[model samples]
Target: MANTPHVYVEWRGGTCRVKWWTGEYHENGRKRYESKGGFTDEDTALQHGQDKLYEIRHGINVTNRDGSTPMTQWLDTWIDSISVDHLTLVSYKSLIENHIRPFFKRKSVAEIDVMMFRAFSKKVRSVLKERSADNVIMVFSMVMDDAVKAELRKASPVERKSRRGKYERRVKEKKRPMAIEAVDQLARNTECHLGPSGSSLIWTMAMTGMRPAELYGLRREYCWPAWPASDPDREQREESAERYGADNSMPAIRVEHQVQYVNSKLTLLPPKYQSYRTLVIPDFLASMLARLLASHESDWVFPALEGGSMGSVNFDYRYWRPAADGAEAHDGPRVAKPRPALPAVPSYAGKRLYLLRHGHKEWNDEDGHSRVAVEARQGHELPGVEGVYSNVTPLMERRIMETLQARWIGLQQSRWEGAVKIDSQLFPTG
Candidate 1:
């Protein structure tokens, strides 16, 4: 008859109905009402209406809203809101499209739980490596986290571990550094395949710990030995010279940027961790760099065959593999003889060009350089306040350069002695 608070009861024929104002409104400013009909008595209808009112007051959407948004649609919206690096965005898109979407496409965010995630992880681990599977799970967790923030779901179901047992953690393999002998052999072979320029590139990477992308990004102007006293003056350079001194200013490469290919487009971007650094090379390597620079007309220190930014794939296929694996001569009239294989060390075989960077780290660590200095040189950010206040000092740079110079000299002597011994053996010199 009369309205009882937010609920009212009505009888139609043999059935009774109860309707309640939800105390919420649509965007058009109209009050929303929910109704449950087909009750045998007014008491039952009234009790159900009271229970729904309690749910509405406690922030539950009483319109059966759970599981309405599909996981795929929610992930699409979440990905659109992500503002990350182009490469990172590309990786996220790949994981979502290829891995995540296929499994959870039909499910809603509310329906996903820890058990579902564990099953998904099991399926992913079967197809992918441990690290790769972990990355997929991480991306999925990020999407679920955003869903929780948006109130589409109550919480993220992606747990680091299940209550029953531990999930498989990613096992990081210890990177073995290339020994001095291996480095020398690789460098000499690189020279044979790609000439002095490629040899210089490999040696530089070994000594400097620069990323392959950073090495690819190196410009003629970034080489300090090539810079004239008065040409294109920058404050950073002036400060470095003044602090480190003119005579002690060992030839160095300025690691300001990296060149990477994203979405079929070559893009030059800031180095990883935004760690713009200066890498000083020993005089021996500097001299080699100088000779290499003199022969090249292009601004790029290591240009492609046609001249411009060189791709890693191109470098690996055309230069690195052939140098390491050895190549045969074609049967053309003017074709050169087959080049002999470089020293076949198992450690060096099937290794990427980045190993030289790791070798450099080994050299630095062996030399007992400060952790901060080594990390700074490698363009890695040191954790905590030390990274904020600490910087690579002039003395530290000089010391690093000296240590590198000594190592270079020692390796050269060893190689020379080895060569002489082989010559003597071949000639049977008295």
Candidate 2:
């Protein structure tokens, strides 16, 4: 190659050095060169020049200048580069600033190696709870992983090391599903705390296994199962569905999107994992849903107390707390008398509405349905062979419907035997 590197004794100082041609001319048409010096002898300097020449010819530049990027600086770039909902972004930012940033301090990105990561993990555990520490570690790992992809580091140091000995086993409080009786009672109590309309939320969520956000985003048009054929607009709607290529099948709710607040404004986003599925529900749930729809002209199947989509804060503090733990006089906005509380569901004394979702899975399991159908109904994906070969059958869907209906009937009988009057409208067949 022309203008290649050569080792020589300097004319000015008689010192040994290597001058490498960069193969590029400046704007003024002068050759640009790079030099490495301070060698004690001619042979050493010549060897250095030869090695650099080979690297230049082969396009094998291994310089890692990106390692000089500081942890704090990279973090800012990483956070800005990530794409997520506003709520999730807020959570990641809070953890990065409050938990991760302080530990990393002013360290350069290169300094965070496997050993450094292990020491930081231990340090975080000492200050934070097990779960909190795990969350912080998870976010840090994600940050570092992105850095690796950005070529700021050669490799990621984060790993899920198996814990051993006394500190190894994580203490996980498993959520146990509520009994059919407990579910009915939770629903009845919810009726008292909120109103007749709000009670529908309990049964629908329990039977359908929809995520809370999915339920909140349920529009009037998406509910096919709940709409009976007898409605006056049924034919016109069916015609419209055919024209638009819609699935107007019964016993299903289309889970296309979820309502979430982004910057204090309600935004529609795809369901978790982008699992846009249609959940086939029991006939009992469909009937309950129909009644609910007839009662409200609002677009959402389950609207908030003040209108629009339900807020997590209001649903938790006002609805779930009062429904599970009972409400005192003057509780909630425009409240008056106290409401009687039911016995809290097993493992759900904290009033976690998510347990209803857990309970739905248990019921499906108890009914001896195939794992594929159960997973599909719950919007969860199976792994490996099962995910590939398994499919939900018609028989499985029918079984789910029959089991849920029988459970609702059993609850009615149990209530009747206990000298409690059954509402006629609740069970017209009875």
Best by TM-score: 1
In model 1, state the lDDT of residue 249. Answer: 60
**lDDT, candidate 2, at 219:** 77
Regions of model 2 farther than 4 Å from truth: 1-64, 84-88, 159-167, 224-250, 328-347, 419-430
Per-residue lDDT of candidate 2, residues 166-225 (tens digit): 675557667655676666666776776656556878887888788888877877777754
Q: Please, what's the RMSD in Å of model 2?
A: 6.5
Residue-pair clashes per prediction, in order, are 0, 1
Clashes of 1: 0
User: Which candidate gets the maximum lDDT versus the true structure?
Assistant: 1
In model 2, the clashing pairs are: 225-251
* Whole-structure CA lDDT of model 2: 0.71
Alpha-carbon local distance difference test for all models: 0.76, 0.71
The reply for model 1, stretches above 4 Å from the true place, is 1-23, 33-67, 162-175, 227-233, 244-248, 325-338, 420-430
